[model samples]
Target: MDHFLGIFVVANCYRNGIGVVRSLQNANYWYQKERDKQLVATRELPYNVDNGLKNMLLENKYRLSWIPYNEFKNIEKIGEGGFATVYYAVWDNKYLDADIPAALKIIHRSKKYSEKDYSEQFIKELKAYCDIGYDNPSFLECYGVTMDDVSKEYIIVMRHALEGCLRKNLSSVAMMGWQNKLTLLLCIISDLKTIHSKKYYSSRFT
Candidate 1:
């Protein structure tokens, strides 16, 4: 219980710019603290943890290996969303055997959002991502989340999509013959069926 609440406490600190200078890294660090403590307790428990719970935790546990901000180099702004700006960055993964090209989505420094609002939104979005899980073929792979030490801001790390958005692929779309386009459309429709049946969002091709 302490560790669970500690996650939020650290998050609150980041949201309010209390002692932490509003760092997502600090908040993420505490979130992992709770997860690590829980994992330890689970291993020590006498009874078996339910397979469902175990799988769920397993799916989300990669956050424990949050990448450090300094590891990213040559960040190029790629896109922007309602709440965040996206960048393509080169990441040197200390834990992994090789370097990875990645995408970073940094939350906008909003003037209108209060600390509480930002904190709540952060938790909500993070939870959504965690619930979605990894290993889905249709979605971009997420590396993890981290914060810039100098900026005191959080950024989400994801596998970079070098081909760019579907709109950029429209020229190829126009070049395709009717049969090929039909096959592509049929495939998309099939994927859409799966997505709808699962009630999940995912990226797909036209």
Candidate 2:
């Protein structure tokens, strides 16, 4: 069982005297133990200035498992950025269960970039995604990372926006009334507030 769940069970036992004497102190101790476990897990992440990128990726919960580049089928180039190109692909989840209709972000190994320059940008983007994490409607869910054997490029697996970007959706739709616009703006603001409230800062695109 997951350690978090185990910790909850222990706390519950202490609270109701299921197997142990009912004591508020004991219940709180078990809860604190779980909190300490999480802190220890976090501390396990490497954080050296010289190896910042790799160290950040060491937190495997968000770092993800390796998938061969060939596993993704029907890849269609959707967009491009200064450092990476994005694609929509069908992910093969034979090894590990994962979501389908995923977005594949491939890094551009440009001649203009030195090893350090390319890695720094890639790491920055990856760290941002890991910080956002899973199960939030406002942010894209990042599944994992993979490497292209042929191209030798790093790939970031993420959730695909089926309707395309927010800018595209807004332009494609008919003119909206003030009420509709206000509703959309409010929703966006709410999501932003949630992100800001968290200790981890998220750099998100709609």
Candidate 3:
């Protein structure tokens, strides 16, 4: 199996034009030697694969369908604040084939709060996100929520930002030219205006 894998890797590298021609030549030479050894062993041994190997292959297949959190496979941790940790994850949209990315915010269920309070806060956050809407592309969009099976922790998922957070971008303001600073200011103002409008509308309705 290792020999077969080596040959596959070499073939893939060759096809993809990975590295220079000389590197590919060396890989192909080594791969050919391994393949010859495998061919010689084929007649001597009975093909009996262990259950562990089979299980590993199955796990890999499952992982290819969806990204795992612990492995940090497709998700990248980009930001964190008092309330939540943010990750830039590939949004599957519940489809195995979908490769679109999105931002996922994980809000920890505070041990200090009661279950009722936690639920209420979750709802409020959802409402706030909805009220804000997707007016500005810079504004994060809430995609969905999920719960951890064992821990029973709730997580809020949102759209991933390719450019990252405002706080981080502001760190090197001196390096930024006037036009860039103006653009950043505009985005901040737009976000604040949306929040203010929502606050006023909600207050009047209440």
Best by lDDT: 2
Leading candidate by TM-score? 2
lDDT of 2 by residue, 1-206 (tens): 26555885786566445666655467657755643443212223222222654455455655354455667888898888767789999886553343257799997788888778877777777766655543232355566666666776677877676565776777643587665565556545654665665555544465
Better of 1 and 3 by lDDT: 1
lDDT by residue for model 3 (126-191), tens: 556644643332244454454444555555655455467545555676687785566446555655
Q: For model 1, how big is the CA root-mean-square deviation?
A: 16.9
Q: List, residue by residue over 63-170, the lDDT tens digit for candidate 1.
A: 423556788998888777678788988887654434667788787557897755665565555545544432222234455666767665566676676455657767
RMSD of each: 16.9, 11.5, 17.9
Q: Deviation in angstroms for 138 in model 3?
A: 5.7
Against the correct fold, how does model 2 do in TM-score?
Answer: 0.58
Candidate 1 regions exceeding 4 Å error are: 1-64, 135-137, 176-206
Model 1: what TM-score? 0.56
What lDDT score is found at residue 16 in candidate 1? 35
TM of each candidate vs. truth: 0.56, 0.58, 0.52
The ten-residue window of minimal lDDT in model 1 covers 38-47
Order by lDDT, highest first: 2, 1, 3
Structural RMSD, model 3: 17.9
Clashing pairs in 2: none
